[model samples]
Target: MPEIKSVPLSRAAAPRPGSASRPSAASLRYAAPALLGYVAVRITGVAILLIAASATGKDGMHRLAGRWDSVWYQRIAEHGYGYEVRLPDGTFHSDLAFFPLLPALERGLSALIPPLGVAGAGLLVSWLASLAAAGGIFAVGARLYGRRAGVLLAVLWGAYPTAFVQSMAYTETLFTALAAWALYAVLTDRWITAGVLCVGAGLTRPVAAALIAAIGVTALWRLFTAWRAGEPLRTQLQMVVGACLAPLGWLSYIAFVAVREGHPFAYFDVQADWNNRIDGGAALAAFVVEQFGRNVFAGLGLCAAFAFLFWVLWLCVRQRPRQPLPVITYCVVVVVISLIGSGYFGSRPRLMMPAFPLLLPAAVALAGARRRTLPAVAVGVAALASGVYGAFTLLGSGPP
Candidate 1:
């Protein structure tokens, strides 16, 4: 066994070992760069993408600012989600698909300050959420690897081109923030708190199934290990309670959707009516091919979607080849479930955004690699360029 050296903030580090209640040098040293770098990178990416999109016209822009997703999100912010009459289908599609949490948060914050309007409130929430999430990511990384790797991981995700999604009226920032806190809680064995945060995350986005699944796996591992080591049953029981909280809300929603129709998976049926459901893997595969066949850029986006998933799996394999069973299980399952499920491939990038944290260590390691730096920089530039182009095309193309 490796000797555990005493860290500087012994008293403060007790139990969880890291908390804002008492300041510690290690905490600030690691968390500061991560926070600052995220802010700088996001501002820079948005600016660069904005400028490039302006220069390139529609093709270039679609790759940049993104499309009506942001607009629909804002609409939900202004007007609550409700079913609007279309044509044939009597089934209601809640503009509610946008979800209520982000807008509700924005409105709540804006009401607190007299001067801040809905827009200002929304920005404030995203801004704070982004910073806090990066901090949480830093804590996780630092604990798992080292301070350098942790900070680098946080910065990598913080500066990612798609981070603009966090800054917008979307729920990515909220979801990321909740997931980070939940992960931090799990790592520290704050089971109840972790479950609470996961519940919040699940409400933010259905994808939180990944977090719950991961936590459950981790808890089960703990239970098995405890039994093998001849530990008490109470500890294992508590872990079970902690892991179960993460999925309660999601399950309830699915049940509600099912009750609304004749069956539980009826949500998929309604979703299909929106041109948003998948017939099967064959349908999705054929659709993806058709999309890529549409144009050079569409093909590029498709490639990016696949690459993003691969990136997460690749990092998980390399860095945590033998990670806590729960973390690996949750991440792999979520990515697979998402890939196989129905939805437009274009949504995949955003859907897969939570996987951003996986990019950190690799980026950090690459940062130290004097030779690999150039190629890394080139790939980032290309990604930024595509995001910019995508944004413009999105505005012109209207809703998907």
Candidate 2:
């Protein structure tokens, strides 16, 4: 079991091999390539996507950059949450459509390096979030599973085509970083810190509700276990605090939006306008059919969703490697809700972004892969192709 020493949130290092035995330089050196490989793939994926967009036309490419959400993030980065946009409907739309954390980070980074307005800030945030995410994944796999799993986790994340989403201004990287760290903290029994981080994550994206829900369940389970064992009253109290963390982000944002947008639920209404509504089977089917016909990346997006379902079942049955049940549960729930509850098919896969960490266990399993290097190469190539699919569409618009 990982040691539980009370430390400040900022002071807490990821649980190591033990309190005494730190990993060696050799271990660090061994991990470098796997980490670098994941990063390289993400960068290449972004470049390819940009090229594809440039070659084709800006319309599709703009969508790839997430004009819908990214533009809001950009708007937020440019101007903090003001909550009043004159919508096509003529009534005001809430800035609450964009959460606070990403813009907060963008503004912070811009203040630090003025040259990095929103785009630069987004890029820097993505890179840092990616690195933090890799670290959290490594810490989770290594501490809970093993060192090999950690290396594989890093490689898998770096090599993921979805990493391209991070390459642009997408909020996945930031949310993942926060979620991973928060998960790590939860596992380590740092409940208050976990709650705070979860709150940050909630502010980053609504999907973070999954992470928060998972952590809340896990914390409750632990509290129950403690009560059964008669551990202590204080531990249970921490559970209460931790349970409160994740919702703070969303609630605060909603409150802010209510003040600015007239209706507290205005964000959801705006989402409906952009095709992000909650509906059942028929609505989702329409989206899937449309996205399948729209482009190749969309098709890959569908394939990955199904692939995740099959793979998760295999993980649950075969290895049953214990880490966070909530992690898997969170993923399954988010995926189902997004796919089914979501009104837009084109948005399903993108909405399924939180499942990115599920790739860690698969990567770990691949540690013993027969052709390890090839999987890396294969994934890298696929990412480049999928990401750049729009670049070809973007460039035909009369630009170099």
Candidate 3:
């Protein structure tokens, strides 16, 4: 019980006897291959986008940074919300549906350096956030596994099917950066930092619910064992207070929406306007079935989509790399929300982007591959595929 209390409840799993400790500068230096691999993938993605855009006579930069959700965020930053678009079907989509932190950062940075502009600032935020997220992922993986596994984890995250979103003027990268660091803080027992980052993540995206739940559960576990562990009063108070702080950003946003829209549940109603609701994967399951029946190939593709998800999940559980409770909880919640949420079936992969823990098993496998060249080759092939897909998606249709 004392040992259990000492290990973070955020990661309720038992710690390995020789789990690597916190990452240091030297560890980061050793992560060069991972960092370089990520950069190479990003470059490939961007290069493909540029080439496709040129062939079509469109501005590549604008397409990547100024369309879809990016436009909505820029509008929010430039005009301070209160915007709405009523679809032909009569559903009103409100800018309030978008969270605030990304736009707020865009607004501030664009103001500080006028040349950067809103879109440019957004891209800057995303690029920087991607690096931060990578570092955090590497740190977490290194601590739990080893430097090799850590590096591979970061690289795999960069090669994710929706990795292109990390380069866009979107909130995904920003939210992921906050989440990775917040989880790291939890693992390291930095309760205050974890709470603060969770707050920021809450402000950036609706999925902050998962993060808050993780923090709250961990805090509760800590409190339950405080006496057995002989925890000092100060530490217990900090743990409780930090947990309390986790939900304020999300609640504050909800309250603001209520006040602004003249209804206590206006935020939820607005989400319904976009068909974004928790349907317990019923909608997702139906979507898969429908797709499968439409065209055999398309159906197979859809099946493959879910198959990939389950495969990663199976690996994570099978590897069971001595993760803490918070990491496990965060990973499960993100997967649930991503898969079970209604509408935006195309966006589900992007939504699952922050569930970095799923990569741990794959990373472990890659790290143990007898032939070092095989991992590099695998990453290269994946990057090429990802780049082509990202370019096609951005150049061909409605924002990715």
Candidate 4:
């Protein structure tokens, strides 16, 4: 592998003179290879899933758009949210725990086209969002590293172990698309654009807190630097405006829930009912220790996996032409949120799907490979493994 070179921070953070932050026709053309590669990987995964589903006499489409959280989203779309379930354990699971953006999209889209039901509309939204996410990921990578790295970064995201979720009727793809573009906007100094995208992300998922924090932190840092440099307030006004706008969507939803439930912390209460409230990793530690009692190898493997996650994160932290402050902040918050939550252990990877920045190290390495065919071979193997795992997990008794 060739060593990856880093650009100076000033060069990395500042857009080239006269270059627009928004993608141009030329930028789209440059990103076409990445988009196509992402599509191909996703298509291959779906193909494998369909073949496996057929062999087992199962409906792949239904599995993709009608299972687990997908059902919750569709229910919200078709009948709006007052749904709840009383579990045998005397706990309640309320639909309000879910964010409303995906459901809203499903309802609107299905209403526009009668032939596509709510579920079908959800699948459509997810599929399209996945493509947009690929484009945004490519743009970020290309800006920081180069076109080749950008292409690999997008493709690698599509070939993630839990990339299967990107195809299902879930908010992961939609949130990721918004988050990726939002980070890109921050990188390019398009403060208001970043904040707008952050608003969309906030409306889509509670994890939008990470994106909100990233934007807030980045804006504060910019304000401080600008002030120290004696830059005028007019130039820093957009940063302040963007930071203010970034949290509104999330705050609005929380306020809505508070009013609806007649409690100040109704949103947190709802999450607690679903057992997803953050516990500072206490639950995660206990779960891992319990796994050791059940099966030592499984416990060891889990520990190793977590170690690997942190190692990759460290790589991101130390990445050459270092990642912008917003990117690092976003990725770190996403990981922390994913691990500290007391939700079902099986869902952690899916929760972390929006943390696409963690894959930067691997993308960089692949881009620096000496053998031209090495990256393609690695991607092929990864896609194959991911597809197999996805089929098994999706078809098994548990939710993925």
Q: Candidate 3 lDDT (Cα, whole model)?
A: 0.82
Question: What clash count goes with each model?
Answer: 24, 23, 7, 0
Count of backbone collisions in candidate 4: 0
In terms of lDDT, which candidate is strongest?
4
The TM-score values for the models, in the order shown, are 0.77, 0.78, 0.91, 0.96
Per-residue lDDT for 80 in model 3?
98
Top-down TM-score ranking: 4, 3, 2, 1
What is candidate 3's TM-score against the reference? Answer: 0.91
Give Cα-based local distance difference scores for all models.
Answer: 0.63, 0.64, 0.82, 0.88
List model 3 lDDT by residue over 238-339, tens digit each. 777778889988999999999998999999999989899888898888887888788889889888867988987866654443566677778888998898
CA RMSD of all predictions: 6.0, 6.5, 3.8, 2.0
Q: TM-score winner among the candidates?
A: 4
- Write one digit per residue (lDDT tens) for candidate 4, span 96-154: 99999999999999999989999999999999999999999998888776778889999
After TM-score superposition, the amount by which residue 8's alpha carbon in candidate 4 deviates from its true location, in angstroms, is 5.1
Which residue segments of model 3 deviate by more than 4 Å? 1-32, 227-234
